[model samples]
Target chain A: MPAPTRVFLSGCSMMILLIGSLAACVQTAPPELLEAVESLDRDLVAIQGAEFAPTEYARFVQDWAALKGRMLAEEDVIRWPWEPNPLAAHLQKVQEEGEQAMAVATQRKEEDRRDAEARLTLLDRRLRIFNSRVDEMESRVVLGQRPIETELLVRQAHSFLDQGLFARSLQATEQASTLIVAQTALLTTELKRYADERLVGTWRQMARRTIAWSRTNQATAILVNKADRRLTIYRNGRPVVSYQVRLGYNGIMEKRYQGDGATPEGQYRVVKKRDRGQTQFYRALLLDYPNAEDRRRFHKARRAGAIPAGAFIGGQIEIHGEDGLPMSQTLGCLMLDNRQMDKLFEKVEVGAPVTIIGALKVSNPVALALADLEQFEEG
Target chain B: MKQPFICYLMVSALALAGGCAQPPTDKLTTAEKAINEARAAGAPTYLAEDFAKLEGMLTTAKREIAEQDAKFAMLRDYDKAEQLLAAVETDAARVNTDATKKKEEAKAVALQAQQAAQEAVKATQELVKKAPVGKDQKPLQAIKADAQGLIASLSEVQTALDAGDYRVAQIKAKAIQEKSLAVQAEIQRAMTKVGAAKAQKDKQVKKHSSR
Candidate 1:
């Protein structure tokens, strides 16, 4: 009975030992390892959801897969009770790396958002400047006669800004700016040409002749430069006094025909002098315009079809006093203030030589002066 | 007799361990559903950090359950996993609510910004209309075109709002406001300059005519 009992007991002991050993070797991952893997998985999902930098996300995925593979391989190794799981360390490393990757991705997303915001702000500012400059040009009436290319460029720039293409918007705005500056230059050139090409030479000859006539007669001679809106009184061949004058609405150009609002250019004599009550103006020194040279030019212009038929060479041109009205308001006359007209009338005779010319010089000042004169004339 | 005694002890231990240890299936499913609900509520866009934390917790809970499944039958214990999953469900619900509240707030702000931008565009357009047509016309027309572009960008703001990216929509609208304000300021300056120039010319004309 003792021998059989001992054999049964030995077999039961061995079976219990085997069962306990199998339980101990189950190789269940620790809670921490599972937690780390789950954390890593969450990070990967976030990375994907965020649409992080492709290179960084790809690297993170590869490293995560490698660590996961290593953890699964570690499961195949036999584990004994009281021994630490080998995969636990690897999983912890993967989790740590995943966390780092996720952090970087989050940071990158924040940075990208900030960068996009900054770009939008810059683009907006640039578009504002572009818009303002265009407005300025339009306000100045600089754009009415030109092509619409600048506006198109501005629109292109604005579209670029709207699309978040900051560089393209900037480029378009710059192009518009360039076009505007070019147009300004072209306008300035045209203004200078009007004064230089047609007015300067005639003025020099008229001024010299008037000075000579004054010196020879010891009398006052009047010389007017319509481009400068200046009237000079020469006494005994030297300048005596000068006064600012105004002319017709189209005063910058030479008067060519009747009803043209331009002050005429030529040598002439004062046909009559009248006091304030006798003339519409405060005082008047009427000139014999359409004198020999003017009549000749008018006849030639008519013959060449430069002037319309039935348009006569105008007469009754005068140096008049406006009292207080602007001299520019006259039809086609040289005008001065009443005080200046009174002073001249006191020193001049009815037949005194009077010369009216286009300009005094060929410089930009003459052009600018004429343009300013034209403004006053229009007003 | 001893072998039977040991077998009885093992069976009793197994029964005791199994008695209180049910799988956390219901809690896990509940937590998963909560997480899905939060995602559908736009938690990721409006509450990124909070949503990520919730996701990590859910993942940890699922991993704990998986760990329990990997264990030997006698050693399996899902009590901790079940508790964590229950906590995750609560956190997910809170996250969803908070995200919805924040999203609504952001939407209000975005709407205000969009209205402000539209107003700016209108103001700039008015300025363009009042702008004089002269040498400055080219630049003014260009500016008007830019203002038109800003108005067009409002559509993009709408797109962002529709997509539930309220923050982005607000930022874009703010940009438009700033630009339109600048355009208005520019128009004011131009008008002032034109006025000053006209005044000076009139003064000169009066002085010359009076003299």
Candidate 2:
């Protein structure tokens, strides 16, 4: 029974043990190898949070997937057989590539973040300046009538910045700038047009003639430039002093007829001097505004239908002191601050020659721009 | 007689191996639960990449279990399947934590950006009030149009935020803030130029008057 039977049994057992061990070796993936692949996959996922270049990321992903597929396909290969596992080497290469990609992605994200932050910082500063300027312009010119359009542009620029569309943001900003500049020019021109127009050649000629007459007669004379808002006193043909003055509410145009609300232009002479309380103003120097030249012009205008036919060439035009109202509040009068009126009253008498002109100087660009703005605003 | 003994030995070894190789159901269930928790924690929105990786690991874990189950009872190794499931569980938990943190961060960034955009709009409105009205009228109108566009973009950003797209919202808000600021700067520059021009003109006038 025994010896032959025992030998056969021993050989069978040995063969079974060897086969089992070999199957185990071939069928199971090494724990370390599996862990490495999993780690690489996790890294790849982490890099997705970064703004990696799409093509590069895709290549990295493809390599990783290919390596993973090969590893899974060769799951039955022994890790440390007679030769090293081909799949393991491939996996290591893929893992390294993945790491590099992740690093690049992380770097790219940081750069993008920094760029965004920098742009934001710059934009914030610029916006603040623009906003303050708008406030100033409103207070100084438009008188708080904010432009709805500008508000819309700023909002758009903000939106572009939010989207990280720097180019678009800049475009909106540039448009806004252009608007601001144009508005500024308009405002400047509107505020300065009257003053600028007064400085023309015809007005200067009359003013020069008045000065020459005053010097020859050794008489006191006055020259008023409505545009410059100034009144100059001359004695014996020499300029003595000047004072800021205000004009009629509608003083920008030459006076043509009665109640035009315009200070009359051209040469005249003071017909009377009234003390305080004698006239509506603090003091008054009445002028013969409808002298021959004025009456002639008035009649021409009336005939040409420039003014109402029945409208008289109003008289009693005066250079008067303030009546506690705006400088331009008088009815066809040249108004002055009370202090200046007192000084002029002391120095002048009746029959003084007076010349009222449009402007004292040529119009500058700012004035022109302001005038344009005013025109637009009025329209 | 020896053949019977050998057969008995082989049967006992097979039985032990099969018993040990029962599907790692407990580990698989735990991993799945962790993955669900990560999803609930907003991993898909705030930590999308990490969440996706966790999902992949979970898929691999399930596949490994299926492979083990398909094998012959004597050859099956549930230990490897269990290990994969354990890895998945770990990854899922990490994803949940990371996602929560990222969500909070994204929300904060988005909120800050929204506030900045609002401030920019307000500033722009003020500027519009003071904008010039003359020859620059056309340009001013263009600026107004841009501002309107920005206001519209703000709504879009809000929509993105509501939809849980915090990254998109944050980006939009940032762009708005930057662009609005640039506009403000441009206005300031224009104002300065206008003022300087006026001053120079006044100086020239004074020189002429003195002469």
Candidate 3:
């Protein structure tokens, strides 16, 4: 009985302990497997895989949980040393799927970021281009509040981009672009006459005829091209000098009657040259506006009900100085800066022939600017 | 005398036959309710990263519960899932509080942006008072229009802020402020031209006086 029996029992217990230790080693996750799973987790979290690649992310998480549950449930099971670890293989597959999800999420987030950036760029470009046209047309009064509304929308879109609201940012940008296109269309319609080759040709012909007349008479003549904002002087059928000029507040319209803020169009003469302090607008070369043709047209309009009952053929039109003021607000006149006026006041006598036309050629500033804006709509 | 998971399974089996080892229903409900509250507090918007982490935790908990339910009833365990659910509840609540605080901060930032834009527009208007009236005829009308446009844009910032879209309001106000500064720069350029012209005129006047 005894010492020999105890030693045999101890050896059996030691054998069981060695087998248990080997089984636990099989259950333990390999270092590479642990690293792969952990890395995949980090990538998913970093790229917001749950939000961007929801389906794939869910599958990966389920697979990972199932693997974890199996590893824990089989912790005490015994297996042979040479048998492959199925858990390691399964973990590999799960990590691969998770990596795919990460890739998808990364690509989607990048696409959204690019989309938001593109919309921002387009909106910014449109704002700049449209604002420039509005400045040139002085058409803010005409389009009232629309440009302001568009600006607000564009800004809101930019804010949405900042807050990672790509869809909202794109929507707002689209809306602002629509407004800009509509306003550009309105401007296109308003300035269509400037694009008309026939109308432009007629105006150019009128200027040419006046220049020809200057050559025939061999006397000093003045030509005012309103669209170009140029006033040129001709001596002996050749232009000797030119100056930049300003017109009426509503300078685009052809003059009609008394108090109409429109510069008249036609041939005329400098009836009086009022020198320093003689006129309110610094200096004046008062033109003989409302000539025979103007009076005939005025009466015709009055009879034809195009003119108001009390409307009269307007007068006192002049080529004048800007009075050294910062702004040159004109009413039914062509105004030059004081520096240019001094030169003009000395060159022209009281009876010099002066011709005023809207433009001498096609492709005026207004026409060119409208075409640039149209490209945005077309693109 | 048994493995931890096996011992847990044995205990679960000995519990009530039909209602044995339930799937953390109360904890799940609390976590779901907290997540909804966090969403209402703007967690998705103001605390996106943290909210995303909370959502991931909820998903893991739900998946763990599903894994446990798939096992035989006698071997069911909700321990890991319940711990995750408890974490989700705590995290969701923290996310809600943090989001609320972030939204308030955004609102303050938006207000500051609006005030800055208003000040920029005011400064531009003051510059407009000195805008050049040259023969080209641009600075006065264009600057006035820009000033008016900026003023009108600021109202939109207020509307967005009232609607609780702080980012939109902030961006609108900031853009308007930039536009106002740009307009002011243009006006300054025009004023410089005006000054140059005046100096030339003064030189002429002095020459005439000497004569």
Candidate 4:
């Protein structure tokens, strides 16, 4: 080849190379940013699962900065060769990239704000839940249902007293008194060891005792004791169904917080029921915890913004089988042992009204004899 | 003819030098070095994890943003998408700090509870030994009951410390401390009984001696 022709060809080849590199940079920039954005998406999912860890956030910021740098650098390279001065184009490209990055960064900043706010909300929820638990414990100690440990202490003191240890007995009594005082102060000022006049009045007005009468082929009265925490499904006044249950740990007075673990206290109807799929936790009676009063309170509180949005109450309350856990573990729902839960599941219908009385004479011999008779008849 | 070969060799050398280029990092600015240091300190990993999430949300946000940007960009209005993106990014940065603060607070609560539990265990250990013991049983058994409570509380505290799971520790500690206080009172009662028993025995001995 001639010298002139060879040199011309080499120059042309170099020009094509420059043009190709510039085009490649332009094409790759947005896609790289998009890829970086996709990675950010995955991180967000992980964050949702476990709140936030410091290391996780640091990584997020680093990637964002790195991607921004790359975008700027690539833009500079593109613009470098295009200006009157060979390097002028690179400067121009860098400026363009800086502007674009500023825009991206600004948008990123807004996203960061929203995520932070959500995280704060979740943190606040956790804190409230913790405080509620502490408050509940204090209340329980104040109530008559003293912790089993305290009872053990009292029992131990009496045992020593029985052994003619008068001094020891006095000491134990003193200890018990101290504990009672401490517990009372922590719980409430108005605690009573015995059912006082106030309690009697409350119980009378509420009609703590009630009876559900069901009759078999022959007619008889089926008596229920609200105090005993048991129900006897009677046919023709003959008891057919008998089961033990743990009523509200706090004796089902008022519906508590969303997860206050309190049993709903109200006159609610059987709104819905699920039979077969009821897990060990519940056999499936969705009680209407939120009667008119509850709805009114909820609406009033919500309108005032006292509770956050999406705070649902009285939605999934139930009187069902103990979910795998012991009966004592239920938040506020009526709980029965597995064997009794299974049996109750079979007998109860969807629409059967479950009357939750505050107290009743469950030890009614008539009811017991009737249940025993039914068992004998079945056998 | 000799000069032609020399010139060709020089040109080839220059071309090769141009092709063998190093990355721009060699000429890194002070800001770039600082950024790199932060990245090396595991900052990048943290940021990546966080931004990856943002990027993900930004995809939908970006799409909506892009649509807005496109719609507005058509009318030469980049304001809406730009404003939205800016707002979202700031919100996103806050998420990390908020999460960290929660964990730290939980840890703090747990720490308080654990310290309280340790005190209770120590206090109970003393009371257990001081309490009266029956002749038939081992003295340690009496101590063991107290020890059992101590052990349970300690184990809870230890678990909390190890896993940094302070919430459970705090709860366990509070209950343990309450029980410990009650136990201390019981021990005091037992000591009084011991004193009375000795008094009664002494009275009988004096009566017999007088006879």
- lDDT against the true structure, per candidate, is 0.68, 0.67, 0.79, 0.48
lDDT of 3 by residue, A1-379 (tens): 5999999999999999997868655655677887889788777866767667777777776666556655666566666766777777888888898888888888887898798889789779878978888667555544555776787678678777876667788898889988888888877775666677897888788788878878998888999887777899998889999987777755665677876657888889999999887987788999999899899888988999987999888799999987655456676788887778889999999889899887776788767767777876787
Give a tens-digit lDDT track for model 1, residues A1-379: 6999999999999999998997777665567667776766676565443355444444444444444444544555677877876666666666666677677767776665556446445544543553353332222232332323444455455565565444455665667666655654554453454466555775687789899999999999989876567898999999899998766544544578987656788888999998868887878999998789888899999999988899988888888886332212465787777788899989889889998876667754546543543343233
* Best prediction by DockQ: 3
Clashes of 3: 2
Model 2 chain A lowest lDDT segment of ten = A136-145
- TM-score (all chains, Cα) for each model: 0.42, 0.41, 0.75, 0.31
DockQ of all predictions against the true structure, Cα-based = 0.04, 0.06, 0.29, 0.01
* Each model's iRMS: 10.9, 10.1, 4.1, 17.6
| Alpha-carbon RMSD of each model | 14.8, 14.2, 6.5, 25.7
- Flag the better candidate by lDDT, 1 or 4: 1
| Model 4 regions more than 4 Å off | A1-176, A182-226, A234-240, A248-254, A278-282, A296-315, A324-328, A361-379, B1-211
* Stretches of model 1 off by over 4 angstroms after superposition: A1-379, B1-22, B70-75, B137-139, B208-211
Stronger candidate by DockQ (2 vs 4): 2
Residue-pair clash count for candidate 2: 50
In model 4, the Cα lDDT at residue A371 comes to: 35
TM-score order, best first, reads 3, 1, 2, 4
- Per-residue CA lDDT of model 2 for A94-113, tens digit only, reads 66766676777777766755
- CAPRI tier for the interface of model 3: acceptable
lDDT tens digits by residue: candidate 4, A319-361: 6664421212444667566577667666656555455543333
